[model samples]
Target: MTDPQVEPAPTRALPLVIAPPRGRQKPPRHLADLSAEERAAAAAELGEPAFRVKQVAHHYFGRLERDPANMTDLPAKNRDAIASALLPKLLDPVRTMEADQGTTRKTLWRLFDGALVESVLMRYPERATICVSSQAGCAMACPFCATGQGGLQRNMSTAEIIDQVVDGASAMANGLVPGGPGRLSNVVFMGMGEPMANYKAVIGAIRRMVAPAPDGLGMSARNITLSTVGLVPRIKQLTDEGIPVTLAVSLHAPDDELRDELVPINTHFKVAETVEAAWEYAKKSKRRVSIEYAMMRDINDQAWRADLLGDVLNAYGDWNWVHVNLIPLNPTDSGPMLNGQVFTRSRSDDMREFVRRLEAKGISTTIRDTRGDEINAACGQLAATE
Candidate 1:
């Protein structure tokens, strides 16, 4: 007898390309890509003093100023040369769209090589958050994702990634977004790509984000969240890296058979190994790992699956080391459809029941607030289409 509550898994199969294409044009070098010492050396190579590098760093990191014309502290003769050398223009704003009564702003940027990526700044009453992309498009090829549908163009350089946050910070500092000029308090690696695949650049960007001002953005490491589709090796590497940023595992389904279809990476790293790796990360980092589950109607949103998920997470001795963030499926019109069936968001009653089942197992759970759906700026919808 078939279980009426569970829908049959999609018949479609997606090709898994673990490696990004080779020989793509590299992003231009900017100061954000280098360490403080490296930046000083580069400045000296340009015939400028080390303090000139510090002045430019202060303007870029402390005052949120990027324009050389506004950096009056530098001598007029050397200003443009230093700025041109260290702070090459990385992200050119192509178009920006606003939502949520002008509180949510999404900017589409054109990289120097013409690769398009997106960043979103969302303002709440107390704090603002920016979701930045780590790569131009994605190679993960998860069938339900819009960016995955487009495939990967290239991994963004560290400076390219940091520039998005800098742009958002500048906007907030200048009173561009609503809520009267607030500071950007949080950043999430959830915009357009699977961050773990672009590990080097992503970690570099994170280092720049948490370092003290005049050297980097000086944001708290705790305020940054990096999401991955259960990249086990990368998760273990992050555990040993000593930086304590929160880790989010996008485990859409609890069982191997279902998760293999939902998150294609599961075929290589099964559910048990993935969840255990996440648990180890939590134990080491002392930061709770987030389990991100996108609720799709009749696909992975069954109450029984929620119970299974809670059990899987609790197997590591349930020391409150994990939290389940149930995400409402933000459907994309351009996403791949299987057998003429478009993936849809779970119903309200089903979502409520899913929450109840997880909480019953002593697992903390919350439904993520869906935002910017009207303008296609929500989760899983950022493709940066021209």
Candidate 2:
């Protein structure tokens, strides 16, 4: 079959070497950032009745309402003031592009300080999932990721992270997309940042997502998945938090030699140590850990590598406690440029063989369906360009 005719993604010239951002803009306080007690205290500080906090929380989290006018539970005079103070605008939509008949939407957001981040909302027949960023850029300088090329600007506040979910939920609730009014079912921290790097704020955001309404969005903890690039210590810390959100480790390569080049942090935490940490989390949390491997043609997609990956994972735990998600790498700016990124995508047969090899080893694996590639849907591509 011939490939569909589509325009090539415009390359935005960027520094090959990533650099730390010099300055950042501070976003205003958001209600999601506060605890139940903190929200009430904040309301009191604004000279509003304590009950006002619940009313606002109900509007934002419960009803997916963000506009002050829709928050009629609060007095007309105080609604605007309270909403403005507690729920200040944190993410400004710079651009929105939709694919898959408008069921898949990718949004480019500009934070208060002019820093750029991207999120994706994908609606299916049975579920709607949103991928949100936890940081402005990214600190993990993975050579094959657009965000890694940009480097870290700053860590996003809890409210900023939660606000992305609220936006996705709001979009689903209002029938703005192809699917009529729906509820967001899944949230993934698989966008620009390394979620574990922003540990505290990301945890706070997760709490706000799973906490009962008036405190959080009230989504099931199981529906949330946090992806990390093998942050060994942080993974152990998360096990103690008692939140059962699925942990996804981006283990691009199974061996230290390749992993050190693919995921630079491997230099600090070797592959064996990282997988061991994930196994510990799975043992304690009783949740199946997801191992994410992005398949690149001839780079890490060799059949022997697949067997090695299975052996490495098998050494830690059984199949029930772990699963592998093999992603056919998207053509991004950071992808190999010798003959353009066309060579970056692993062939279907190669991916299938890779999955078969893993499953044959009594390990479970699945190939991830690529989405939004036409619009440069891979994390930082839009932000880096637009």
Candidate 3:
């Protein structure tokens, strides 16, 4: 595959906010935010018996019930009080749009502070997956991403993050989605914000997700996929955390020169360094790291670039440690920051050639299925409009 004679797009300067701004009011506390010991202490503080908290946990985490009115086993008099203190609503659904005959639902949620975020629930024959947001908006300033176009509002609390999953689970269990009563089988942190940026809260949410049914969701860590835009330090930290969640690095470009413009954070952490961290993570966790490359018409979709990407990943030895997932660029109207540039999805032939180049180097690759296109299923599109 020869390099095509295509002129590179001119780079433009955009403001980037790597760190979230300070002094934003935190979201209300919820039971999902606390440990078992903390929940019992909270129950005692609320003038309820310790066992009451356990029962509530069973309802929330086990039964996927959020309304105090539905908790019939608890004493009716204390249900409201206990619910008010521990199960305060974190996400208020502003709007829900469905696609694929209602099997895919994208929800726009407003937090307590009125900051907007979005999540998506998709059902398949074999499994159900929910893509949850970790923050209100994004700070990465990835030029083509809708979430990054709107700067970071604030970091979401752990409970706020967990509520998205819980709500999705409730929807599935209640048969609200197209499939009749089913359980959520997987979760992906690929919506709205960078999961690694909100490290503490994201980790807390994962802990609650993998804990036992009475205390947490009891979902397998392998079922959760955490995506990052190559935050090297956080990737290393996650590798050391001993949690075996799948890691996905949003590596839009194989070279630092292009990545610096596509992903502003690349200016600090080069492509080699970021890939190294992901490689190290795969080695330690014994889990394959997914290389997420968004195919943009001619910008980063050249056949030569695909070969370069293969070389880059194979440099660390092709022990099946990495797999490439090519995402078709979702359509978004060009905003001011884009300098009147519109990124189009790659042509099917070009994409095929790109895949061929990678496969030639023995790199495992798969093209991601783009779902809910009519509902603007891509992260931050609905929230940004709202």
What candidate 2 gets wrong by more than 4 Å, as runs, is 1-25, 332-334, 337-343
Task: Go through the candidates in order and give each one's C-alpha lDDT.
Answer: 0.83, 0.83, 0.85
lDDT of 1 by residue, 67-107 (tens): 99999988998889889988999999888888888988888
For every candidate, C-alpha RMSD to the true structure in Å: 4.5, 3.9, 4.2
User: After TM-score superposition, what is the CA distance of residue 255 in candidate 3 from its true location, in Å?
Assistant: 0.3
Poorly placed runs, candidate 1 (over 4 Å) = 1-14, 332-335, 338-341, 379-384
For residue 145, give model 1's deviation from the true position in Å.
0.4
Measured with C-alpha atoms, the lDDT of residue 206 in candidate 1 is 96
TM-score for each prediction? 0.94, 0.92, 0.95
**For candidate 2, which ten residues in a row score worst on lDDT?**
1-10
Candidate 2 overall lDDT versus native = 0.83
Candidate maximizing TM-score: 3
Cα-lDDT of candidate 1: 0.83
The residue pairs in collision within model 3 are: none
Candidate 3 structure lDDT = 0.85
For model 3, give the 10-residue run with minimal summed lDDT. Answer: 1-10
Clashes of 2: 0
